[model samples]
Target: MTTVIFIHGTGVRGREYEETFKTIEKKIYAERPDVKIERCLWGDKLGTSLLASGASIPRYDETLALDEEEEEDKEILRWKQLYCDPLYELRLLLLKPGEERSDNPFAESPLDELRSRVDNFTPSDKLQAKLAEAGITEVFGEAREAVIRSNAYNEAWDNVSAESLGEYSNVISRAIAAQAMLICYQQEKYAPVLTNAKLRDQLVELLSLDLAEAELGLGDWALEQIARLALPIGTNYVVGKRGAVTNKISPMPCDILLYQARGGKIRDFIRETIAEAEPPVVLLAHSLGGIACVDLLVEQSLPKVAHLVTVGSQVPFLYEINALCSLEFGQPLPEHFPEWLNIYDLRDFLSYKGSQIFPKVRDELVNSKQPFPRSHSAYWEQDKTWEYIMEILPR
Candidate 1:
């Protein structure tokens, strides 16, 4: 019997997360009654709680009351204590300066350390140049500027009645955080780096500082905002909470795959799931989950995934970051690589055609008639998604 293993992507947790898969399971069972299906729940295992609910907001009077000696150190110390060290290693990995191309054409330079990180896997000279240009300073500058210019926060506060201060603030905080992520992700150049946790933290840190300067507190509300923004990038939760906050933060679907690809806490879970499953196993992974499955096949040397399918995944873009654990540049597909099919919609910015990049894989482009993330997410709800999976399953 074939066991179809469904691995979910980021921003999913609790009963709601399970229900999403259960809906798919029902669909799968109806078509292939003999097939067994199970979901890999890795969110709680690898998830970190970065935000708290009840951090004290510094009053404007308090800011005014601070001694000159305390003022200079306060901002610096708050950022350093909260964010600097946590992002240090990641900054090192991503921000190393690139060397100029030499006249000799063969001489390596100091930047090779950065280049070697994804030597063969580098996407293109143009893309490499773009990656080389990436720096935390530029990221911070851009985010800070955007936050200062945006009227979204002010409007949110203005709309709040005195009686609804608490609830409105929470909503506004989430909106601002979401807006920050959206602004960052919408940038074509920066979108690829959004998966890099250190960079994401840097953006949030700078944005938080801007918010604080604009009178938002560095309290539980801000922490939660940063945490929520960091979710998509697969960063470990760095903020701590004091009072109870509503569990509105969901796991980013990409986090599970990104973290697992990096040898995260879910490694054993993946191994055990594959080992215990019945033979002729098929992997039906969505979004980043597909990338995780590919990583398993390449990095872990598991050759038993007979059939593999991906829906609305960013695997092609991941190839640009040198993050895809498998399929290095110019390398032939592994002899044991599973039969692969990738499905995506044109409207989904995150989804891309993978067959051209990974020649062995088949690509299916369907029109979702939705915009952006909705297109990325709408795959499961469509009948065509099921048809494609059923078409590939062993008869």
Candidate 2:
């Protein structure tokens, strides 16, 4: 059995994190009971807490509070301690090179002297008795554990949210499946070996072929739909009745449009993720994720990607440019590609019939025959897609 590593995409954190992980795990194991799975959590603990409180957690915050303070006076005090304190700056200094449990600057602060007073500051019995005239009462409880989790935290931490739950789930599953597939790709498990560079070229060529074949074979209704999605080639169109001719055909601009619609900040994210990760990895992009992958691949920024698989993606035809994908969020795709597969469904209206950019590796191109389900998400539930992906996975 192959081991699959799951990576969550934006707006997922806190208690919702536990539920999301559990749901994905259950789905995978239910399909292949013997498969071993693990997770790579990129989330921060403190960010989770601030989000739970409905406060914006900046990247600099590192601790999450379990209990909330709501009293007007207490809330102001909590804000000073939590947000404006020298404590946070001190923490940063402590985290600097070669310092984890060393002495803190707080020891030199006036707060340190105030803390010292606690040793000798208990009230005397006579004083307590005198104060009893006012009839003041105080209540205190021992500390107990409390859990804080929310999608807001996830958005704060993961930079994703609940509204696009379906899309995010699909993107995460593709990454997980790619990790599983990388196992086979490394081992050359399938009859035709597919490497990242080879697969990318092959897929681009296949997209060209498939688009050609689809255009040739489509019924009148299908052709009309394709025409609607395509930018008119070799023609001049008036821009906004200014009556000027433009050389290029512009499709509806789905990738950038979806990126904004999904509330995702796509630009720095993919490039930053690629810059940060270590080598020898697989990239699984779902829908807009495919656009991200194209950005990384085209730039040759992610040279270590062993394989890439895009599922239910509209990315293959996203560009009018021949090189990299021309989405607004990232730079164009490479003329050469990584080992990749564009998985799609005929019934799913969200995906293109065939992407236009993927080029062939050798004469041989790997296209698995499977029916991707109705929803953009149903690919995860299909045994054929999962099994085919596993067969190509690198060990």
**RMSD (CA, angstroms), candidate 1:** 21.6
**Which parts of model 1 have CA positions greater than 4 angstroms off?**
51-250, 253-262
Give a tens-digit lDDT track for model 2, residues 60-161. 313223332232232123112322221221222222233133335555432233223222233345423422321111100000000012222122213222
RMSD of each: 21.6, 27.5
Write one digit per residue (lDDT tens) for candidate 1, span 89-206.
Answer: 2222122233233334476432332223222221334433433333222343344344334454333333323333333333332333333344543442233223233333333443
Candidate 1's C-alpha lDDT? 0.52
Model 1: per-residue Cα lDDT at residue 187: 45
Q: Relative to the unseen true structure, what is the C-alpha lDDT of residue 192 in candidate 1, on a scale of 0 to 100?
A: 24
Q: Which ten residues in a row have the lowest lDDT in candidate 2?
A: 139-148
